[model samples]
Target chain A: MMIRLHRSPSSSMARLIGQPDLCSVSNWTSRENQLHNRSSRATEQLVALCKWLEMRMTKLIAGTTISLDGFTADAKGSPAALYADFAELQQSEAMQHAYRTTGAVIMGRRSFDMAEDPDSYAEDYEFRTPLIIVTAKPPAKHPKEGNGVSIIFATSGVADAVRQAKQAAGDRDVTCVGGGMLIQSLLRESLVDELQIDIAPVILGSGLRLFENVDQRKLKLTSATSLAGGRTSLVYEPL
Target chain B: MMIRLHRSPSSSMARLIGQPDLCSVSNWTSRENQLHNRSSRATEQLVALCKWLEMRMTKLIAGTTISLDGFTADAKGSPAALYADFAELQQSEAMQHAYRTTGAVIMGRRSFDMAEDPDSYAEDYEFRTPLIIVTAKPPAKHPKEGNGVSIIFATSGVADAVRQAKQAAGDRDVTCVGGGMLIQSLLRESLVDELQIDIAPVILGSGLRLFENVDQRKLKLTSATSLAGGRTSLVYEPL
Candidate 1:
């Protein structure tokens, strides 16, 4: 039987299914009708599908690492004061992959201090990613505009800050770049959704820890990637 | 000037000091001299003391709030889940303060089915006070026994189950408690440190909430309190 078409020939769906002689057109029309029927019949199911995709799409995480001891700073309050250098780890392919995939970076006041040039780091970061400085202090007036980053001094709350950052990132990722204090603060607030740690080969016998004074909780390793140079990267999705 | 050596014959220190002054005590004379010096220093410091007193400590926080959208379930499965039930919040508080002060409680598998729990919550919950749970499914299982209340179940991953439940309970108090997944798998992986929650006021609309498929990184209130009525409660925590 010929399938009657509603639209013009330019509508490929209409022309392809309107031919009278070909069983191909008949089968195509039937399939289209079946799809339409199913969509209408299972509206709830379709909504669920949309929701599932939306959740997956809208999902974003800020990943960072700190020492086991939970100290993002040293006794003098320098974030880089605690650890040896991360030069080797930073140069790895995994680090590059993470940087490329992430749309933006989330940082706290203490973490921001570690960047050699807070302003320049925010401005000319190699990745060209957006920078979000999560701080309780009021934002300083930008010395100039289009520094390639927008500084947000989030005093109101962490959740609110993340929400704003996520929106800014659109459909990309947010990487939490720093040591323990900011991460710990976020952890204390339950704001960080995922944690990815690159366990370096050497351990500092005594220095600022990654999670000092942090509440006790559990972390499950969702993915573990072992790098060539005795380095291991672990990805954990909060339970 | 040489201080007068005299025994009041009252206090232990005076008596001992005088004995050391005696020549017959020469065998242990050095020890007695050391004791006498220490006693004299104590007396001098006591007399020099300006003030001595005890004080209670209270850390100040800006404030926090956690709201349960109709996502969590009650015993029944319903969309209109309990957002804030003051009664439940009180129960959670009581569970922490009365039952377990220093230990942990477990959560179940179905409890945290949405998102993974973050480490931020865990560090906050477990630093001084610890909670723990067990589970096998999406939501984490609540931990029972040891040093806290029993388990509640939410089927989820090991790390998140422990992290979220702990963070949901902020500074007020908490103990580790989760259902099957948290305990069975997370516990084995050592992700959970404690469990605590603040039940809220109002009844759930209907359904198996409290543990459902939630976002892996969602957290509501950190603290909750019981109200005048036995049934109503409030759960609020910084997000």
Candidate 2:
């Protein structure tokens, strides 16, 4: 008997089973059947498998573009210097992959307010998924939403915001963008799984640093690739 | 007629002449002779060539190993975390190149003091070159020196120290080894020609930062190579 599973859900199951290409549960079920020789044992194995899959379903990624000196934004809270090569970097393979895999976004209230036209993000932003704003209080008026973009004001806390975002993301990844405080909080709580930085070839002597007050965490370099216009993309995973 | 120049001296001469591989001065003199066709003019050209070679003979390089988050040392002034991959990175091609090209070293007093046994550097340190110590006052007793390593105390200022170091380096490069203040002063004076960083895969939340208070400068990425043990070697030249 063969059991078909959703590709994303089964991908995590495959990873858990050490067979990354196993897209269906049929092979594992057959093996379990052969080993147990009983229906009850098979049912228990399937339940355990589902629990494992649920645990590894969603990944939280903190991503940003920073200057060579590690500043995410200039003193005036402007990221203009860091985004000089944005047009070119936006077309990079890693960025395209992020766009394709991002199922939801979590941002701080300041980042949401920084957007000139929040409603425009619904149509123009690359990650047209849901947006969860972590704030102490919800805004007086909500922005218009369409094109699969819905805003949720999470007034609870960072952990709760992450929970809501993960639930919304389902089997895809939840990406945290903007506000170093938010990322630092996530890093402190061990909620962030990946950290992605695109280092631009400029030095900002004074600015808002990306890693300020971040909890100490050892990272393993997963990838380092030179991008367009002298930018470098470095991806790290917590070890 | 062929005019042979020392390989290191002529390397810079070739760079100045826009012919990087023209090790011998014959090609350039021959072309000048054809253009001028006068003995007196040839003498003037030779004098001008000597001055140009003098100006471009030595390059000042600032090199260090830093954590992924840009910390050079831990809170207690220990670089243990940053040098975790030092053994592997030291054998990398970029490190070997730096070792081969460096003709002298400049370090701050604190960095020199941090050495448990300063005399041992004469025999063990990779750069086995003359060490220039920039301090407010010279130490009461000098450390023992041998094997082409001599210590010089420069109390005048960073500029005078650089000038003396460049004179000692001759046609080879002068590498600034430690202390952020020394590097920052050199940077403020626009004395640094190259910046080389070996980025280790660790994060130290609190430590000495490398680029703190550095002047704003644009850099051109000369090279970015992944070295042994997940360390990255990034070389940059100020634009």
Candidate 3:
């Protein structure tokens, strides 16, 4: 069935979108006319422009890996020790890319708890950014302050935490770093903007999952990288 | 306002998930109980899993950058030109990851038209996989045949193409390499399984968009990576 899809920019929706003032009525008409022509070639170009404007509203970042069943760590703070070496993860191109764009980070109680260990969190997270811990309880002692880094406490609603983080970001990117608990909260509120995952070679037989329950939502992969140690990193933009 | 959330999984339509045996009522209850217990984590895990499964369903292998105004490409089939060096792009970790997991690829007619340059396609596509072109008209010629590469012609239907692709993939992964028109069809029919995209460095003054006139389906990034030339890669799993 050859459906005649009119690309009239002056159509009611286009008029609303174009706002006669924003796009000029004549400009809208020409744009819509192109759609009316049903040019497979032309339609592709137009759609791309609309999407670019929509994605500019916010920025979000996520990083985590859990059991196949989807747990971030075991009952204790132990995070199932999946990736062979943080050294390899640190050196990968994906890691470098993550560091370049992110200006702030949000962490869950559990992830923050693990991060307190100088051996793991301190040495592991060398990237300089303001870290916000989204938890019910504040850390016994903040690390960033002592180490010439900024560590802020955000123990409230996810939206509130994000607002605080964005304010701290000051036109920079933010990364949501956590296991399942914190990530779920941000996701439910739809605060996350970009997700980066490192696929470790091994899957724990039984442990916590990064995902367990939530209404389904779709996401698209924007980039991918495979490390030498059988680890693959993928980046996603929400669809 | 505490919304009295329903405790039963039946309402969420997850009652049938992971059910070991569908024949008995008692077992069903037990399965539901087990599933419920597993879901008791903080809401964060649920969101991640939702995003994960979401991307698993709809995302195809290829990605395209289109304008926000809703066009797939310009009148001449040029969606937008990527100025990033091809040599550097070829060596990027993200490209390498795509090569590693991808066993087959599919593209729509519009996307195929962009590949009109046989030499660039031949030189850039180093990974050996069966590339299937879905269109009404057959190609005028074949370039890289008999080197573990073959181009099959399909006149209609993405679902059928996927079935044929699975046969070709054998044990490897299959990807739908898209142009906007093909993606629209796939998204409408729900044939896509994964979406991987590399947001290029440049935004065209105007061009086609990745999604146009589609349902409000959601996707979550299972992984993300940043590349060398300000390029970012993301992978989405469909809900």
Go through the candidates in order and give the clash count of each. 149, 0, 85
> Model 3, which residues run further than 4 Å from truth?
A1-58, A67-71, A74-77, A116-124, A140-148, B1-239
Per-residue lDDT for A54-116 in model 3, tens only? 223336687875422233554454564555557777787677877786767777766667644
Model 2 per-residue lDDT tens digits across residues A1-239? 11223346654553455432334546577676566446556555775676545435678889888887788888888989887787887788888898888888999999888878878778787788999999998877788888989999998899899888977886788999968889888888788888887788888888998888875667888888888788877788877
lDDT of 2: 0.79
Give one digit per residue, the lDDT tens place, for model 3 in B1-239.
11222223221333234334434445457778676556544244554454334323322454554321123454455643442445687787766776776667787766666665754554566667777778777767755565666767676567777656655664456777677677767766766556665555342324454554454344545665665655555565544
Per-residue lDDT tens digits of candidate 1, residues B1-239? 11222222123333343342334545667888798778778765543331110000111111111111111344344323232243454465553354433323344434433325433333333323433333444233332222222333434554554444444333232333433223334324434222223222222223332322211111222332333322222222212
**TM-score (0 to 1) for chain B of model 3:** 0.64
Task: Give the Å shift of residue A11 in candidate 1.
Answer: 25
lDDT score for residue B49 of model 1? 32
State each model's C-alpha RMSD to the native. 21.6, 9.0, 26.9
Worst lDDT run of 10 residues, candidate 3 chain B, spans B1-10
Better of 2 and 3 by lDDT: 2
Best-fitting candidate, scored by lDDT: 2
For model 2 the local lDDT of residue B180 reads 81
Residue A18 lDDT (model 1): 36
**DockQ score of each predicted structure, in the order shown:** 0.01, 0.58, 0.03
> Docking category for candidate 3?
incorrect
Off by over 4 Å in 1: A1-62, A67-85, A143-148, B1-239
